[model samples]
Target: MKLIAFCSTGMRVAAVAAGIAVLTGCGSLPLPDKPQRPMVYDFGPGLPAASSGPAGAPLALAQVAAPAPLEGLAVNYRLLYAGSGQQPQPYALARWSMSPAQLVSQRLRETLAAQRPVVNVGESLAALELRVDLEEFSQVFDSPGASFGLVRMRATVVAPLTRGERLLGQRTFTARQPAASNDAPGGVKALTDATDDLARQIVAWLAELPVPQGARPVAPAARP
Candidate 1:
């Protein structure tokens, strides 16, 4: 009986030792690496206040459409080598807060709202419609380090007629500004400037269109 009890106690001790060894081995194993955080950027406050233009009827602005790349929030850059074709690349660690198209639309709406009543495409009482197609929004590197922010978009204005919606006017606007640095922040700054310029141009263009009959009149100028 004594011999059997001693053997059972030995076995229990061995089992506990094995369990301790397994736990120690687990503690020594390397842990998974933590993920790195990416830098996010956004266009600063939209372009300076454009000259107040005569407001026409309420205008509806549609969501801007862009290519697959510009439609994302990634910060994209283009390398313009002498031989290589234009292939855009996104920065691995840098990104935009919102897609370029969305940013541009926001800027346009804010800038235009200062001068006239602006509404979305689905608004019930919109008198005129504005549509924009974004072609390019990228930082083009001329050489290894030199770069500029380029923006190109086509704008169309339509007015509802007795028959149907009639195309009032259409135009393409382009703006390029030299980047202050060869980094994402610089690119964002330049792009914001370009967007502001585009907004000003669009506002001017809308001002020249003849107001339709029964359209709302321009809002009274603000008191100084």
Candidate 2:
């Protein structure tokens, strides 16, 4: 019985020593590498100060709306050569700083502010309101080596009514700019250019629209 007791004691000591050795070795083992975060991008310093001077009457700008697929920050692309029906796919290591709709809304406001006073959607100071629906914003690839940024949107100019809204004019706009290269950086650059182009086009369209004479100021809602 004493011999057995001694053996048990010895085994325990050996086991503890082995555990200590394993722990000591772990300190020298290299730690696992950390994952790289995706690169975040946005439209570079917006359109150079508008040379045209301060804009006309205040134009109410609404937050741009987009379909579900474009509501995220992922930088998306579609392969046209692969098939006409290919769905958009996001880049693994890149993303937009914000959703495309947000980016477009911001860009539009900046560009439009150059030509006219731009206000928020609910503001009653402006007789004209501009609402935009972003339909498509993505990089399109014809082949593995070629791509371009494309932006499509529908714009509606409306007059605010005391009860609702009246549409003054509506139009669809699209802009496509060739990628500088076949990669994400190039795609972003192209997309930025396309957005700028689209903004300019919208400005031109607004110039052609006759101001609504019957536009009434939106009345503030009554508290319950």
Candidate 3:
């Protein structure tokens, strides 16, 4: 009986030791790598604080409108080298922080604010309203090594009436800038440059437009 008991104790100790050894080996086994996150990009910090001076006519800016594809945050591009009929495609590993329309709208407001008091729709009574329709905004590749960013938009300025609004002026603005490289980052930079140029064009257009008769007068500034 003493011999049997001793053997049983020895077996239990060996079993415990084997179990610990298996657990240690499992812990040392390598784990699968984590999936990589997609890269996100946006128009870098916009222009510095606009200088304070005599503000231009108060202008209400409506939310920019875009097609279904541009309404998403995808960084879109086209490969002309692939085929002339090729459709635009979004980069798989890169995306914009906001939809193209939203980015353009933000850019417009920032740029326009420097020349005028840009406000949201219905924010300013009897103010001229600027509405933008974004038609095309993407990077187009001319060759495997060359590409350009294209931006096309239509803008309409309208003045308020007692019951509705009367159109003051309208124009289509298009701008394009060559990509520094044939990559997503290069495309984004080019797009930004095109947008800035488009904004300047709009400013010049607005300055040339004559205020129409029968339009409501600019609203008085509210006293703080």
Who wins the lDDT comparison?
A: 2
TM-score of each: 0.75, 0.82, 0.80
**Per-candidate RMSD vs. true structure?**
7.5, 4.3, 5.8
Off by over 4 Å in 2: 1-31, 219-224
lDDT of 2 by residue, 1-224 (tens): 99999999999999998878877876555678999899999998787787777658779888898999999999999989989636999999999999999999999999999999898867657888888999999999999898999999999898887768787899999999999999899999999999999999999999888777767768532312
TM-score, cand. 3: 0.80
Model 2: per-residue Cα lDDT at residue 221? 29
Output the better candidate (1/3) by TM-score. 3
Ranking by lDDT: 2, 3, 1
State the displacement of the C-alpha of residue 174, model 2, in Å, after optimal TM-score superposition.
Answer: 0.8
Tens digit of per-residue lDDT, candidate 1, span 53-114:
63666788888888887878888788775443277888888888999999999988988887
Question: What global local distance difference test value does model 1 have?
Answer: 0.80
For each candidate, the alpha-carbon lDDT, in order, equals: 0.80, 0.89, 0.85
